[model samples]
Target: MEKADSCRRAAVEAVADVEPPRLYEYIESVLDRASMVPAALTLESAAAMSPEDYVFEDQDGRHCAGESETDRDRTQISEYDSERIVTHAAGVQLIYEGLRLTRSLAHDEPWTVADDDADEGDLAILAADILVARGFYLLARTDAAGKAVRTVQSFGRDQTRRAELEPETASAVGPDGADSAPDSLDANLEHDVLELAVRAGAVAVDETPSPQLLAVATDLADAAGTSFPPVTECLTDLEAKVREQSLEDSTTDRATSATDP
Candidate 1:
């Protein structure tokens, strides 16, 4: 939880540059509540984890900082896994919320420049900063940091369009063919973040990243829409596929060795 918690705190620190102190404090509090989604996902997975699934017999099924002959730390994690995606997803939500608040000031509306709206805009901008900071903090050190970084950049590009939205452009806020608010954007962003997490996890474990992982992440994201669930069955399937592939590779190598001169 410490790595997870650190990601959230980093987001607040990011707010310091653009948000007022009071507003930063407020966003910090909001962030605390918003981060529970990923945490819950991890806890649920651990709860379901059978002892035979993990390496060490006594390992608590908790996130560890790193792996060594003797990895004893309880507060940090050495491997990048799905949990990082949760932190990143929370950051995405915080940033998107902030952007929405600030976008209210765009298009030169009569009330756009009002004191309250301007203040809201400031807070929104600051919140986004925090999200980005938190994202980089949680992801930059990972093996799949590049994938996550590119995903964040893509999300930023999407934000540009959203932030520029005016009254006439309200249609863009909804999905392509739905009456609901444009949940697609959120789903797509989340999918990318989660996909990168999958890719990164693969790399961490020395597995070759596969197209199926992307497909699984994207499919799960689409299923989630705007309000997604904590974790998904696809994640389990993806892990199973990874394990299955590893076994086949091992068997092939053994057979090849047996036949070699």
Candidate 2:
């Protein structure tokens, strides 16, 4: 919840100065329903590798590693500048949400002109554009910028491929064929975005993420599947997963150290 709150605040602040108040208003409203987990996941992924302790409290009072009140106040703060990580997390989240909204509009086809003025759908498009642009703005100077761009590019490709799939030909095509199911195609966005979040978070602490970290990240993304789950659902088990990975890393380091001269 702390992570989600931080992400929302950062996201809102990212676009606080946009022109035409209505656009800001629209984006703000959307945030209420948007899953903040993507950004939270980013923070969590980094905190997992951070040398400093991060104590988390919820209804269950599940702490990360510390038991003292002093540690609890840490609230997942990384040794590196957290401002940068928060910004990166917000950027990735905004891009994902913007694309998600755009996809929904495209699928629903709810276009209409409202008495010579842009209607709700038009406003939504504008909002989506603003969201993505702001997201890029936030990430432009960060190391994760390239990954963010590629994620969007991959999304576009997936959507394009989905558009070309014909219902009648879908079954005729093999499981791995061009005419793959729309759900699978749509799910790629979530998977890619989740991966982006993890990479962005991990890089905040370590220069490069280790193989085990990446494998865990991939498993988390796969578990998320096609639909974007609620923040709680996506995050509840994350600490345990990260903790397990961290333990494995420690054990391997110790074994290697013991074998060294």
- Candidate 2, superposed: residue stretches over 4 Å from native: 51-80, 112-118, 167-180
List candidate 1 segments past 4 Å from native: 1-21, 35-113, 159-186, 203-210, 230-261
Lowest summed lDDT over 10 consecutive residues: which window, candidate 1?
43-52
Report clash pairs, candidate 2.
Answer: none
Pairs that collide in candidate 1 are 64-77, 65-76, 65-77, 65-78, 66-78, 174-182, 175-182
Instruction: Write candidate 1's Cα lDDT for 34-141 as tens digits.
Output: 533332222222222211133311123444232453444332332343334344434444443443333333323434567886676666566555655555554456
Every model: Cα RMSD to truth: 8.0, 4.5
TM-scores of all models? 0.52, 0.82
Task: Give candidate 2's whole-model lDDT.
Answer: 0.75
Top model number, TM-score: 2
Q: Lowest-scoring 10 consecutive residues by lDDT in candidate 2? A: 56-65
